[model samples]
Target chain A: MKIICNGTEYEVGQGTTLLHFLAQLQLDPDTVVVECDTEIIRREAYEGTLLAPGQNLELIRFVGGG
Target chain B: MRIMVHEQEREVAAGTPLSEIAASFPGSDLFIVNGCQVSGAYQPREGDGCWCLRKGEMIQEHELRRLLSLRHTPGVQEVISRAVVGIMGLGGLGSAVAGALARIGTGRLILADYDIVDPTNLNRQHFFVDQIGMKKTEALAANLRRMNPYVDLTLHDCRLTAANIPLLFAGADVLVECFDDPVLKAASFRLALTDMKTMGYVGASGMAGFGDNNLITTVAHRPSVFIVGDGESEAKPGQGLMAPRVGIAAHHQANQVLRILLARAGMLMGL
Candidate 1:
């Protein structure tokens, strides 16, 4: 399946959960906010949401500074 | 009964007294029910529009209240005075933003932070030398009250999160995201965009280095999300956050907050 994460297109195994894909990218679930197809996916529901072909995902990672 | 709190609607007991209502809003001293100042013993009536006056703003005579804001034009000041703004973090950006809004006569302020004042924060964050050991909320509220006693300043002594974001920020017309961590900042803005259900939200990003004054801009990520920062200057080991540059970004957030409030009130100039 082809899913775009933060404007970068990536190929992942079919039926991959949003949580699983994020883990493969070395991203922490708590450190970023997830948005799928313009809808914000809550932290707890990331594992339940399955990515489809051509789906758009946005992972916003926040940094630490004033 | 339904009554307007700060600017949002709230429900309470069948005959909730002004005192009880005032207590829910931390640091509020005078309650305004239907545009009239009421005592603590007064009970709210149906469809009453209630709000609080900051400490030391209790004037028995309406004429005196008018005299206090005599310098500001009556037309726009009314809208500004009725506004309630929330500051999520009481650090450099949060403190400056709150102070600016208070000086502009924003009616109520909601401030949250669990951190305490430190000598290092003196360079950028707004705090007095004598306030080093106190909680940020306590120190900031004290300083804000001194700046504008007429502005109700509510303080929360806990670290803010997107959890229950709506309830925590329900009373404000605008919520300013001012956390030190980028992750918290993003989460704060995301909640405002998706969870506010009501009220405007402003956030900062990439306001970390110096010398690109014009680059520190306010960008509208969506119609609902507004960012105030250079969008490129992240603080790294080599680069640093200085007082002047941080001040600029803080004021940018403050100015954008006012703009959002004015636009909502339909009093925006040249719009």
Candidate 2:
């Protein structure tokens, strides 16, 4: 299955969880907030939430600002 | 050729290189060359005509005004030509803070504001009557640039919403929170803390009313969150800050910022 992460397409195995995909991409889970199809996925559900093909994911990183 | 040193007149060979002029000053630790402070490893070029060098007791340029005046050492002017600081507001406190920072030679400034200058802003804002209808960010940027021509000013004439806050602050080393609204202040604080968690960025708050002067204290350990002014002090609707009081707080904020930068560079220690 394929999914888009940060504007790049990634092919992944079936039944892949968001956390698994993020781990496969070598991204730091703590510093990023994951959004699936414009909806924020809770941190606790990252391990359980499954990703299907063609899913859109946005990873926003927090930066210092005022 | 004529050169102004310590506001006095002096003559050097017309074609003297700046590096040769700098090398002529023996035992001097720093040099203010051509309106920019520099030290160590800067060689003057061929076109570098005679330039002013302001230092102590070198009266070959001009007669000493007074013994006390001769005793006074002009603070070393160190210009950070690459620094980029982001200010969140253009109101009373932000105006004073931005002006002070610009005057002190913060080379780059990014100002963000979504409002328009108003008549009431004349009381404490750094805006003229003609700027009343102008966007606050653009007006403040113009005012700051007019004060210092070397400043590279960018005006983000838009509201700082959560969606764009990270992008706006990505390149800044320090963030100054000058917004007055409680909701906006809280949001900014949260954003700053989150940023600190991810990246090592310094930030500070406070500088609104007059009575809060006593609350201006710099936190020792976490310089990232230097909360100045009384956190508990609240501003009443329709009541704004005065110039003198806000000016003092802004000075403190700028000092803290300088200290933080110096510490990061290993030049300063122990607050």
Off by over 4 Å in 2: A1-66, B1-79, B196-208, B237-239
Per-residue lDDT of B240 in model 1 = 74
> What TM-score does the predicted chain A of each candidate obtain versus native chain A?
0.90, 0.85
Error of 2 at B259 (Å): 1.3
Candidate 2 residue pairs that clash: B19-B44
- In candidate 1, how many Å is residue B211 off? 5.6
lDDT of 1: 0.78
Can you tell me which runs of candidate 1 are displaced by over 4 Å? A23-27, B1-72, B269-271
* Tens-place lDDT digits, model 1, residues B74-182: 6667877888888888887888898888877788889988999999889888899999999999998888877767678777898777785567778788888888887
TM-score of each: 0.73, 0.57
DockQ of all candidate complexes: 0.29, 0.03
